[model samples]
Target: MYSAEIILEQRTRALSEINLNGFGQRHQGKVRDFYSLPGNRRLLVTTDRQSAFDRILGQIPFKGQVLNQLSQFWFEQSSDILPNHMLSVPDPNVMLAREAQMFPVEIVVRGYMTGVTDTSIWTMYQKGSRQMYGYNFKDGMYKNQPLATPIITPTTHAELGGHDKPLSRTEIIESGLVAEEIYTQIEEKALALFARGQELCGKGGLILVDTKYEFGLIDGQVAITDEVHTPDSSRFWIASTYESRLGQGQEPENFDKELLRLWMRSKGFGGDGAPPALDEDIIARLSQRYIGCYERITGREFESDLTQPVAERIKANLEGLAL
Candidate 1:
């Protein structure tokens, strides 16, 4: 791991984008840049661009490598529960994955009534709506409190620069977004994945609070796609400090991107308009946090290859794959 000073110096050096020629048709998502590859596969290059509430905030040094590697870790750990699009990781920040027809709505499994985003279970619960995501919420639930059981709240995938809207199981099926039978299988697999994640995270003294799971049809069968249990796609908290802090009505120590979201919220920005420029200090801190998340969750040390520029390294590493 690099020191704080090195991380701060790398703020401007973070990789925000990398477009390779001859990589076939390219599609840009919030964080990952996808390009069609041979053998009906896709090359997913995770970038350092930070995003929340469906908005790109900024970039953090080494953020791409952390997210890509962490996702690769969980994908291997939970392959028995469900297959993912991951095929190989030739580069620390890139993944060669099987192409799948992605389902339009993402399945969110929440073990807690938390989050500040518009689609958060807590946000909707606070709005005085008892019916949410096809589940009825009774009164007396406190912020950040764990629910009796985890719930699956589906949300539509927003276009670039568009806000995400929440959906229920009934709504998803009724809209023809997904068939009833396949959707049920997706839901069951999603819960199983969450349980696996929670079991592993519990051993590490972290709580896998909630996470968003996306699925796609691979060979006409359901498969987890995009990233899984990555800090960018999930919420985590320190378990030891959770009950104590919540008893005092304080927020738990965040171990995921929620820390950054909370910071963005403090800056008076949610998901609307342009986000303020990320300061050097915050960028460095977020970078450190990303590295820490990788270490804590995977039980591995976070290391960066500082031999060359990030973009140059990635380009060279991918050149062989283009052959």
Candidate 2:
């Protein structure tokens, strides 16, 4: 575990974008930069740039490496449940993956009713909304309360700088976005993946509160694509304090990006004109939280090389792979 003081002293930077020669077209997402490779493969580079409310929130130190390594860990751990896009981890901040026909929906699985976003179920419920994405919630449920069972609430995949609207299962098929048969398969896979996440986090004394999964068609089969169970894609709370916190009307201690989101909310930024610039202290704390998430979830020490530049290290590793 890295002490807060040590993490601040290291003070590494968020990686800048890179261009690899001989790679095909490049596609950049909120946090990942994707480049097409030969043989239907793609090179995905996770950058340190932080994004929330569907907007870029500057850079958090070592953010890219933490997300990439954590996603790589989950991809390897959960491959048996479903075939994923990952082919190999060429570097600490890079993953070479197979390109797939991406599904236009984000499969969000929720086991709790807490979040700071406008689209959060708790926000909607608190505003007197009983129905959400075809799931009905009964009255008298407290904030951050666990559900009877995990629910799959999907949303349309939005373009960059766009908001993702909530989508019901029926809307997905009725709108001709996904065929009924394929949607059924996606639902099954999403729930199974969530179960796997919950089981793993449970052993680590954490709760996989909710997570979003992306899927794509690979060789006529739906395969998991994008990051899975990372702090960026999921919400995790310390299990030991969950019950007491909820009872005391206190927020649970989270290891995910929710902490940053909360801080931004305090600054009155919410998918608006411009986000507030984060300071070095906030950056250091966020970096430690990310590293904390990695250690607690994977049960491994996060090996961050502050002495070496991240771009150079990734380039060297990729060259070694001869890709």
Candidate 3:
């Protein structure tokens, strides 16, 4: 894996190199640029640009490397659990992945109910109704506390300028977006994967608080695709201070993008209009956080020369793939 610094510099340079017209920017997600590839595949490129509270912020040096490498690490470790669309790591920020009929929803599995979004769900529950999408929360004697069991809540993946709403299992099945049998398989696979991730994070002195999974059908086979269990796809908290922080009502130390999100929210941006520039100190600190997570989670230090241009390194990786 490339060092965090090298990854970030390369992502920045790659984004700068993109002409943004030739490939027909298929979709511009918060921090990723997707381009259609030949033979039913796509090139997903991570940008150093950060997004918080839904707003895209200034690019952070090496942020893209952290995201991509972390995802690659998990993909390699968890391939036994399910198949993924990963074709090649052509570049530090670029992934050549199999293009599938992407499910229109994001499968979110919550192990703990302590996030801001979870809190929103709880508040809605207290009103004697669970509100997800347009559906009312199921009626039952319920406590607005952490679930003894984690729940799978799926949300639609909306396009820019569109609202993404939640969908129940029945709704997902009835809508014909995905067959019932396939959805069940995805749920089972997702839960098993999340369980394994939690176990691994626990060993690494971190908690896999929650994560989102995406699925796609490839040649009639449903498979887990996209980034899995990365700092971007999941929230991880330091396990050591978790109990103490929970006791004091203080937020636990997290290893995910929440820090950047919190910072962006503090700047009064929430995915609307242009985001403010982040200062050098914040960027440096965030870079350290990414590297720290990689070291702690993998128990391996990231090694790469940051002084070298990322393009050369990426070109080398691609050439190695050709061999």
Best by lDDT: 1
Give lDDT tens digits, candidate 2, residues 11-37. Answer: 554476767766766788888888887
Q: In model 1, which regions exceed 4 Å deviation?
A: 268-274
Residue 34 CA error for candidate 2 (Å)? 1.6
Candidate 2 vs candidate 3: the lDDT winner is 2
lDDT of each: 0.86, 0.85, 0.71
Every model's TM-score: 0.94, 0.94, 0.83
Error of 2 at 224 (Å): 0.5
**Candidate 3 or 2, higher TM-score:** 2
- Candidate 3, residue 134: the lDDT equals 40
> Over the stretch 140-229, how does candidate 1's per-residue lDDT look in tens digits?
888998899888999998777666788999999899999999999999999999999999888878999999888999989899988888
Per model, state how many residue pairs clash. 0, 0, 4
TM-score of 3: 0.83
